[model samples]
Target: MRFLSLAGWLTVVVATAAPPSVELQLQDEAKQLVVRVEGQPAMAYQFGDEFALPHFWPLRSPSEKLLTVQRPDPYPHHRSLWIADKVQMGDGPVVDFYHSWKNLRRPSKPADGFRHFIRHQRFSEMKTEGATALIEIELQWIVDDNRPLLDEHRKLRLVALGNGAYFFDLTWNLQPHEGDVKFLSDGVHYAWPYVRMHPQFSGEQGGVLTNDEGRRGQAGTNDQTARWIDYSNTVAGETEGLALFVYPDDTPPQWLTREYGTFGPRRAEKWSGTKFTLRAGESLHGRVGVFVHRGDAKSGRVAEHYRQYVEDKL
Candidate 1:
């Protein structure tokens, strides 16, 4: 009897310490990939053709609170979390995939006569290992009707951290498929990947934005170069936040911060506001980490996580 009781107790302890299970579900009809932790959806990747481009929406905190807002008022083009920019293929007109709606013939019908768009071709890979899930997808930068300007390979990895926090790792590889492609995005209008927090988590609603340098709020942090940035707030008596970390690149990055609810790292000065060409067959690469955690930046150990991310520890 004593031995049996001891074994039962050990089983309970091991179960309590076990890491949460992560799962990836592909909903083809919905055109979305839902990532669930322990069977509950933590976030989703929306790639439906109904929109100007693909984006991630409803990024939820550990407490299941929505941390991001999609197409909010004033800036309806700002998808919750996404990447886009202006580009020109050969001598063709510059198409602003970042503000892609301009190429649509009808705002209500995105599939009608869109001239230029980013189309998700297929998912090359999707799998889960232990508490981590990964997705690899192929996409194309399309111009005219069916001409391909660039081929994009994107990978996303989600690691389930205990206590409901998580790490979202993103890597992008863009190769010019046709001729030389010129990136014509200006410094003031772009971010490699933007995060637009929900109104409840915006500075207007008592949230705080802080960078690695201890700069707080939009006025102090806007356009500043930082290794990481965090946004947090207390809502419904619970504190939670999100942080973004940019990997090292040739040109140090600048960021765009807003008090109303937007923040992201911009391309380096050498490329922003100037033409950077990727000759045919050449590729441009980028990587970033999105850390969603409980509590404020300090309490959440945003800096430590960022360091770990840089060292590939997480």
Candidate 2:
């Protein structure tokens, strides 16, 4: 092969030096951490002193379409993207961190005992670059008396995957601060690492839900186990959607899906008297992959992206 001449090489280099299509820019505010892409608002991590638990709200696509919902009238406790569940504190009483937000003021039953809180402690590390942003944060699951029941180290990574798509990865390391802790389900649904889709993407709005097991619709896919689930909708004459992927492991997680647009993997249910135990000083780690694409599942090639994610290609 003949090598390029000096003049030709210089021309090639200059032509290839275009700016990146997307850039991950972060703005740290007093109450929220806002992330922008190409100078456009992408999403915000709401961990202010007023929030009961941290959440990512108003996640937007590269086309600037909102993908998540928060504090809808029907479900006041359903934040956009969050990790939460009813928990048991070893020998102590059971607590409901998922619904016990002080700002929520959800009526509580005395028999329900004291509600708990998940407070954002601090950010341990954060880094952002041309197309990716990674953040590590510490959180405390505490009771009314300020007794910390569990400590959580959560790592979130976001990457601009070109073609109006995005990749989001979440890793959680949880350990009991005082004693053993158990994630107890509410029996009706398991609520952990959840995403509430926007109202415009609801099934009533002509949205479609598909899973790896070839299941479709919210009824057949609910409480089912699948490697990935996609919820797609047509908005303004364009098809776009979000997908959830459960990494390959010995035991795949049982997922919770809804037509109203809430989905996530859940811990075992209380009706089954099941609990995921985390011993003191021992951390329980879990990981998941999320893809936000510009088209429906098939059109977006969600399976292919999921394969790349599993292989760590992206």
TM-score for all predictions?
0.93, 0.85
Local accuracy of candidate 1 as per-residue lDDT tens digits, 1-314: 12234645552223235677898888999999999876778999999987777889879998999999988986888889988888998789889888867888777976695778788999999999999998999999888768888899999999999888899899999999978999888668788888899999999999999999999999989988888899999999999999999887655577899999999998766666577898888888878899999999999999999989989989
Q: What is the alpha-carbon lDDT for the whole of candidate 2?
A: 0.76
Encode model 2's per-residue lDDT on 1-314: one tens digit a residue.
23345755542223333333444344456667776655667777888655667888878866888888888656777889988767777567677766654323344533333346688888898788788888888998877557888889999888877655678788888888877788776756654578899988867678888988778888878877778899889988888998988778645567778888888875423222265676778876767888888888898899999899889887
Which candidate achieves the best lDDT against the true structure? 1
lDDT values, one for every candidate = 0.87, 0.76
Worst lDDT run of 10 residues, candidate 2, spans 11-20
What does candidate 1 score on TM? 0.93
Candidate 1 clashes between residue pairs 3 or more apart in a chain or in different chains? none
For model 2, the superposed segments whose C-alpha errors exceed 4 Å read 1-29, 101-115, 267-273
**Residue 280 CA error for candidate 2 (Å)?**
1.3
Instruction: Point to the candidate with the largest TM-score.
Output: 1
